[model samples]
Target: MHENIDPAICPVCGGDNGCALLAGQPIEQCWCMRTRIPKEVLSAIPAERRGKACVCQACAAGSAPARPD
Candidate 1:
C-alpha cells in the first residue's frame, strides 16, 4: 500500500508545498519556496548577474520577494 504525504504549503500565500534546495539555504518558516533555475536562463545570465536572479515561491505565485537569491 502507498501513503500520501501532504505538500509543504507556504503559510504566507498558501502556495503549494515546495523545497528551498535551490537557494542552498535551510528551509525556515518563510514565504519563499526554492526552485531550480533553467540551464538556459542560468547560462544567459552573467556570473555577476546571477546573484540578481531568484525563483521564490512568492515570486512564483506573484507574491513578494522572499529571498534575495
Candidate 2:
C-alpha cells in the first residue's frame, strides 16, 4: 500500500471502497473476502496507488468507469 493513500477510497475511481477493515471491521468481513477482483481490474489501479487503497465494488465488477489512462 502507498504510504499516503486512503485505504477507504477506491484507488481506481476515487469512490468508497467499502473496505470492512478500514471501517473497523475484520478482514474476513470485507466484501473483498468473497469477491475475486480480476487481474485486469486490479491492474487498472495507478502504479502509485496500487496496493494502497482497494478498488470499489463498482469498479472491480466492471460497472464503474475507470479513470482515464
How many clashes show up per model? Answer: 1, 0
TM-score of structure candidate 2: 0.87
lDDT per model, in order?
0.40, 0.86
lDDT of 1 by residue, 28-50 (tens): 63334335444543343334434
RMSD per model, one decimal: 14.6, 2.9
Report the number of the highest-TM-score candidate.
2
Q: Tell me each candidate's TM-score.
A: 0.25, 0.87
| Runs with alpha carbons beyond 4 Å of true place in candidate 1 | 1-32, 52-69
Instruction: Rate residue 46 of model 1 by lDDT.
Output: 32
Model 2 worst lDDT run, 10 consecutive residues: 1-10
